[model samples]
Target: MFWSRKEKEHSSKKGEDFSEVIERIKSGDKKLRERFINDYRPFILGCVSKHMNRFIDIENCEEFSIGLMAFDEAISSYNSIKGGHFLSFAELVINRRLINHRKKEIKNSKVIPFSYFGGENEQIIENSISEKSIYLHYDRFEMREEIMIYNEKLEMFGITMNDLVKKSPKHKDSKELMVGIAKIIADNDNLYNKLISKKTLPMSDLIAFVTVNPKTVEKNRKYIIAVCLALKSDLEIIKGFIRKF
Candidate 1:
């Protein structure tokens, strides 16, 4: 999704380009800069949420503040020739800042203060680096754990990530309807049990319990089951992504 320099220049014709506005901001358009940041607050929050792997409360999140600063820094440092797309660069900066902020927090939580071991400054530096590495490793480990569990669940229904990406409803109304149907099935004990045991959507029971079109249910059976599985599991990050939709 990274925009090339040519794409950034030409996309204005489609009314989806931000390069011009970014250029204006870079040229010291203070008012537009403020408005631009305000308008893109949701994008900033989304990047932070993805890193945190949960829903965020914008009013209280320190990470969100860091994201905003990082985005502002991106606008200041961004180079169309070298940065690809402004947003892509901004997200990279935001994630890097958030990671560094997290590492500092981890370092602060050490059992003894660095000042306590006056001549052991080198040891403290080594421990900090080690902890940062472990933090990153554990973060990847947790995400992998969730993905493995989700993949296993999808396999039970004979669905792949490719299937979901390709078959997921393109229309907003259709997507909402599918999510609603999935929620219903996930909430009902009998329907959920039947789906788990059968390893397929219980269409008849779902239709009987709800007033949805049977053919629609059948058409999106895999997607419906996938959503239901997400709802039934403890995969907070997966659930967070679904909430965005």
Candidate 2:
């Protein structure tokens, strides 16, 4: 499967000389289609395997089938004069197809079970736990409780639960902001717990204490920070009880 420098150069020259094959394909040549598949099988398989590993849960034969189909599609539609290496162009098409395939599977199908072919078992366990049913059940319950407690605390500062829940962060910035908020709460346990135990505060009053204004709270900076602090306090309390044993 290894190519020497001379062989690599020869392959490149042959690929470049595929201009006629490309034109015939555009004109709908059936045999040239088979030739294209024969020539690019190895390269396409390697590229698909490297990129599509993240999405597919199939064996080597299944992956190869997908890769070959992607290669055939690439050859039929590719134009060499677009200014890059043909293999590179083909790789892009294959990768995109693989990613789209994964997205469709995630959205439409159930979790794939792990079958042992002699590798690490941990990944299988982890993937199993991330199943949609388990995740949705836990996430919905936890998020609802968190929202309720957060509203209760915001009441002391005069903020309504409805306004706070409506102030969710956009997708990209949520995780980092939540982590920072967690650290802040960890550093201030008593205050964090006190806030969580309260009932009603004006939205404006709560925002003023945690942020420069109500708008900042709406932007999620204040809410994330408050959540992080409360989570940290809870963690510490749990750890303290564990230590008593």
Candidate 3:
């Protein structure tokens, strides 16, 4: 059996629009909801593991459960038309859930001692989870500041986070290719400055310089611009996010 050209074209665009998929998932599209979970599972686990400092057992782990719930919350709360990425919002929710859980655990217990360690050491460890929660606030604060800086930087380039979220390349291979294009721009001085100064994709230059399709580059123009700026700027967290998911 063979697929028709129209069928092939329909399949091609089934999941390409990330923002549309997210909105449908929020509107109770069961298939899309499943896709959302499967798609972002690794991302959610990565956030949970980094926050918890270990790989989580999704089968029966509370932290994993919390992370899933937080991700779900992020999905419901995500505004695709707004200027923010879903993963960033999800990470913030995961951190908040973990922090609140630690607070609750600490509050419900009185003189909870760990006999494995001496009394003082156990107390220190127990208190550390609570205290560490406060320090995590600083981490979130730094991310917020970075987001503000990133937003302003993107504005200078005539783009916004909403544009990135909406126009990101559909396939991983396409995204990787775009990342390479971004690297090319980041590695060169003139191209970088031209893009920065003009707030636009140097399409002719990129088409001549980078070995990629002009149509593809233009289709993912906003995302390429954002990635180029992120790679060139001090946006560590955003860079890590792009590299990770």
- True-structure RMSD, every candidate: 16.7, 19.7, 14.1
Model 3 stretches with alpha carbons more than 4 Å out: 1-129
TM-score of each: 0.47, 0.40, 0.47
Prediction 2 TM-score vs. true = 0.40
**lDDT by residue (tens digit), candidate 1, 1-245:** 34456644665454354667778889998877786687679889998887776678999988899999999998887754221346655766787687678667667774323332235364546433455555765467556656766776687678999999998998999999899888898789898888887888877777787787888788888899899888876556688877876
State the TM-score for model 3: 0.47
Error of 1 at 42 (Å): 45
Sort all candidates by lDDT, best to worst: 1, 3, 2
Q: How accurate is candidate 2 locally (lDDT)?
A: 0.51
Q: TM-score winner between 1 and 2, please give it.
A: 1
lDDT of model 3 at residue 141?
57
Per-residue alpha-carbon lDDT of model 2 for 1-245, expressed as tens digits? 34446545655674354555567777987765776677777687677556533334335456567777878887776654322345655665665565456445546655644321124664656444334654464345434434444444344455565554665555545645444444444455453444344421234334434443555444664555444433532223323422332
Cα displacement (angstroms), candidate 2, residue 147, comes to 40
Q: What is the lDDT of residue 19 in candidate 2?
A: 52
Compared with the true structure, all predictions reach lDDT values of: 0.73, 0.51, 0.70
* Pairs that clash in candidate 3: none
Residue pairs whose backbone atoms clash in candidate 1: none
Give model 3's clash tally.
0
